[model samples]
Each structure stands twice: as C-alpha cells, then as structure tokens.
Target: MWSRELEGVCDEEYELDCPACGGGLFVAFGSYGTFAAAGDYVGRGAVGEEGRAELAPADPDRLEGVGARLHRAAVGAGRTQVARALTYVFGEGRCPSCDVVFSVREQVEQR
Candidate 1:
C-alpha cells in the first residue's frame, strides 16, 4: 500500500553514501539536474568535479517487479518528475572517489 506520508517525503531531495568510498552524496533532481555529488550543487553555487557523478536512469522497458510497479504508479498519477526520479532510484550510480559503479537501490539497502 502506498502511504501519503511516504509520498510527501519521497518528493524531496535526499542523500546517500557512496558504497565504495563512504562519502556523503547528495542525490538531487532539481535545477542541478539528476546527479549524485559530494559537494553543494544547489542554486547558483559552483562545486568542484572531484566527487560528482551523473546518475544513469533506468530504462522503463527493462524495469521489473517492484521497480516497474512503482514507475507505473507514478506515471499513472501524473507525477512525471517522480517517475523520472524513480528511474534513477532503480538505476546505477558511480562513485566518483573510487570510480566504482553500483546499483543505487542495492547500495541504499546495504546501508
């Protein structure tokens, strides 16, 4: 079941840790575009490229099980942005520090 409280929280930008380097990463999909960065990347501020990795969104056609279901639900609700973010949630991310690519969902679950 989908919870309204969970939906509210899901709309906000959050953070995650890079599995390889244990660096704090800001996962955002706003004006800074969809990316995971270790430095402040919001607004007009400039950030260094040392720990910035572009998020590779999942392919909707390849999504399965819970990932597919959640993506469909968001699209059905007309929350396209959320749907896009969901793609990234199920997608892969690279650790800028270690240059290791890992599944975003799996890494989150490991923490």
Candidate 2:
C-alpha cells in the first residue's frame, strides 16, 4: 500500500506573486516536504483500510513522527501502481514561476 507521509521543508523557501493577478503565494513545505498546501494536508492518501497496516517508511525523509505501515492487501501494490497511490494525496497545478502545468509526484523515486 502507498501512504502519504511527511518528509521535510523545501531547501529554498520561495515567495512568488502571481503575474496574472498580482496575488502572492508562499511556496513552503506544507505538511509533507513534497506537498504544497495553502490550508491543510488535504494531500493525505490512505494506502490502508481500517484494521489494515500501511507501507513501511522506505525513505529516510518519510520517517517523521508515527509513520504508517501499509498492508499489501489494498489495490495497487507496487511502484508501477503510482497513479492509484497518488489519487488523493496530490493535486496538479501550474507552476507559479514558469506557468507550466506539472504533475507533482508524491513519492521520491530512488535512483
């Protein structure tokens, strides 16, 4: 199962004003390091069900607080099953700097 966990803050905190409307937005670490939320961690995606476990923290960045242990019983059990894993945890939007619509990846792929 895939779980949404907190990592850390962005290396560089950036504040950009929307060129279209002059609205400003602060780009910082939301709840998780990779996620960027203006209000809450609406980016949490549950990889396990009630009484079920979630995935173990495979990455060091995800070992913050009480990490989840995901059971494999849920659907989409592998790295190839990313789309299902990121269903709720992520949102697609355009970059404030470049105005490029990009898919914000939830998991940091190991090289």
Candidate 3:
C-alpha cells in the first residue's frame, strides 16, 4: 500500500468519467485542517475573535486526514481519459457496469 495526504484546508470538486458505463461521476474533497488542530470547529465570526471564532486556514504541511466522497449520475456527458490536476484520495476501485480499469494515484499526506 501507498501513502496519501490532503493538500490543505480547501474544498476541491470535479467530475470524472465513469469507466463502466461511460457516465459522469462527481468527486469532492472537504476541508482538511491541520493534524494538531483537526478536531477544532470553525465558527462564523469576526477574524480577530478568540477561540473558535478565530478561523485559521489549514496548513498542508501539518495535515493528517481529509474528507472526500463520490457520486454517480444516471444521465450525464461522458469524458475521455486525460491528464489534469485532480485531488485524489488514497483508494482504488473499478467500474462495476463496464468492468473497466480505474485507479487512484499514489499520494502522501502533506504533513
């Protein structure tokens, strides 16, 4: 097995081509805070507010975990294989419908 890491405290969203049915799949990455600050909650408030009110962006160098999810649609445009900047989670899967090949690239947690 290989290692994977989150880029930073950011939300990344994109559509990927489904290898099985040639359909469209939506992939999203949720905000990832630093390892030391993972359980802290961010609340809406003034920038200078103390405690949870003070929101500091996540640092990739100190990250440990990231949130992500994927969804499939019945009717959507198909996409071809291409190289592009994408946020990849640490996992692998295949197209169930078409029995096609799909892969997740090797990644390292930034921290």
Candidate 4:
C-alpha cells in the first residue's frame, strides 16, 4: 500500500466517483475525541454552544472498530484520497444520481 497524507488542513470537500452508479461521491473527515476531556461522554463535536453537531452514517458492524477509525482518520488527516476536507459520517451521504446511501465503505471507487 502507498502512504497518503495532507500537509495541512483542507478547506474544501474532496470528490470521488461511485462504483455502483458512476455518481459523485464527496469525501469527509473524522473528529478527535478523548475520554480524558469529559470523562466517559467525551466526543468530537461542534465547538460553539449554538452550532449543530456534524455527523456521518457508519457501518453498523464497524461502528467501534477499524472501519470507523479509518473514516475518522481520513477526516482528521484532512484528506480522503490526496488532501482535502471531510466531516460527514458514513450513513451521512446519498448519491444524487442513484440515490444510494453511503452505508458501506466499498461503495465509492478509490483512485
């Protein structure tokens, strides 16, 4: 496998093509959360008291494992394929052309 990383945070969303329907797939990133910050309920969320928390749909089986972590890592790195921005969770997206939900990581074709 090749190494992928972005030098800095990205301000735009990245794009990829869906394998199922050749639709546009937007990339997203993960957030940082530490249990030390707030006991057991520590999580990544909006900083402001008024802004709504951003979220993404995730694989039900990988919700707490590598699959989930990979999504978060990609987001945290500020890049999905090269170097860009993302925040949406897995179940967070739908293909405009096919109207398919991003429930599985394999839906999008990696390039």
Candidate 5:
C-alpha cells in the first residue's frame, strides 16, 4: 500500500513516459489545471495547447480498491484537495504526442 501522505499537497507534478510513444510527459495537478503535456510545460513560454491533453478525473462513487482506500483516507483526514487530486491521479490521461489514453496511476507505477 502507498502512504496516505502521498495524497497530500506535496506531490503536484509527475514526470511520466507516454506509454505509446515513449515521449516524456509532464503530469500536473495544481494551479495550472489537471493535464498532461509532452515536453517542458512549466514556466516561460511553455508548449501550447497542441502539446497538452486534459485529464479526466475518476468518478468518486465508482472508485475501487486502492483508489477507493486512498480517497476515503483523504476525505477522513479532511484533506479535500488531496482527495480531489487523487481522482485525477487514478483517472485517465491522454498522451498529447501519441494520442494514447492511459491510466495515470499505471504510468506512474511503471516508472
């Protein structure tokens, strides 16, 4: 089991590889919004909309297994933001480079 603390605010950016094209992907869930981008996506003239793909957050009621457990823990601890972020983390992400829709969690695990 992963630590519940991981559901906290400290983790906002994730570097993952696109499962289809093997391109570097920046997965961020913060002020910039929940999305994945191919190549550098932070600060000073970041890649435009063409390089990014929006994240589809999971349905809270349909959460199961680890995703459900993590959500419950976050909600129990009153970490609403964390719980919300988890929905994105456990949801689907499309690769802007290859157009492959993949699981955000599974990609993270692969790293």
Candidate 6:
C-alpha cells in the first residue's frame, strides 16, 4: 500500500455559486462519510407454479458520496485526487436563487 499527502478542502463549510443558476450552493465537507458500495443480497425467491425464481442485481453500483470519495481518494491518490475532489466533486441540492435542483461535479481537465 502507498500513502501521500492530500491537498483539498476537508470538512469544509461554506456556500458556492451555482454554475447554472448563480445561486448559493452551501457546501460542507466532513469526515465519517458515506460511500457508494456494491454488494449482493439474497434475493427473494419466486413461489407458486412458476417454480423458484430469484432476481438480483447483476452488478449494483453507484458513485460514492462526495465526502467518502474525497476521503478515499485523499487516502489513496493524495494530491491528484485531492485536487479533483475539492472541485465540488459530488452532491445534489436545490439552488436558492432559481429554485432548481442541481448536481455538483468537477469536469476533467483536458491536456
């Protein structure tokens, strides 16, 4: 395993402008975060004459929470992920201005 320093807002608390509505987007970063995890569960079996049939997700997955991703990335990639993570990595909120629901994410830098 490798470790490195992280450079980004950790446990940050403030508001940012909404790219679409120019609304104030309150952002608060913190630890004890939640992350997206993939897992399998025992699906309920179908009963009756159809015989026993089960349904399960082929591969359940989704993006981890911003804080979790940031934390993990920081712990893993250090500054690289840290830099990108700090760029408003992820979250969904309603713009106080335009009253529109919006998701926050940073775009990949092009070389």
Model 2 quality (TM-score): 0.23
User: Which candidate has the highest lDDT of all?
Assistant: 5
Estimate, for each residue in 20-44, the C-alpha lDDT of model 2 and write its tens digit: 3443433333233332222222246
Candidate 5 per-residue lDDT over residues 1-111, each given as its tens digit: 256436333568678899989999988887788899997787898988898999999999999998899889989999998889889888899999889999998887777
lDDT of 6 by residue, 18-84 (tens): 5565534343333412211111111464122222111111111244564455545655765643443
Task: Candidate 1: give the clashing pairs.
Answer: none
Q: Which regions of candidate 2 are displaced past 4 Å?
A: 1-89, 106-111
Ranking by lDDT: 5, 1, 4, 6, 2, 3
lDDT of 6: 0.35
Q: Which pairs clash inside model 6? A: 11-29, 36-64
Tell me which of candidates 2 and 6 scores higher on TM-score.
6
Alpha-carbon runs more than 4 Å astray in model 5? 4-9
The Cα local distance difference test for each model comes to 0.72, 0.29, 0.27, 0.37, 0.85, 0.35
How does each model score on TM-score?
A: 0.78, 0.23, 0.26, 0.37, 0.90, 0.35
Cα lDDT tens digits, model 3, 1-111, are 121222221233223455446544333333421111111224554122121111122222332443212111101223111101122333333333344444333212211
Which of candidates 2 and 4 is the stronger one according to TM-score? 4
Model 3 alpha-carbon drift over 4 Å, by segment: 1-9, 31-88, 93-101, 106-111
Quote the positional error of residue 46 for candidate 4 in Å.
Answer: 27
C-alpha lDDT of candidate 4 relative to the true structure: 0.37
Give a tens-digit lDDT track for model 1, residues 3-93. 4323422754456787878887776655557777776665577466765888898999899987898889989999987888788878887
Question: How many Å off is the CA of 23 in candidate 2?
Answer: 19
Error of 3 at 105 (Å): 3.6
Clashing pairs for model 3 are 3-107, 4-107, 4-109, 5-108, 5-109
| Predicted structure with the largest TM-score when compared to the true one | 5
The TM-score that candidate 3 achieves is 0.26
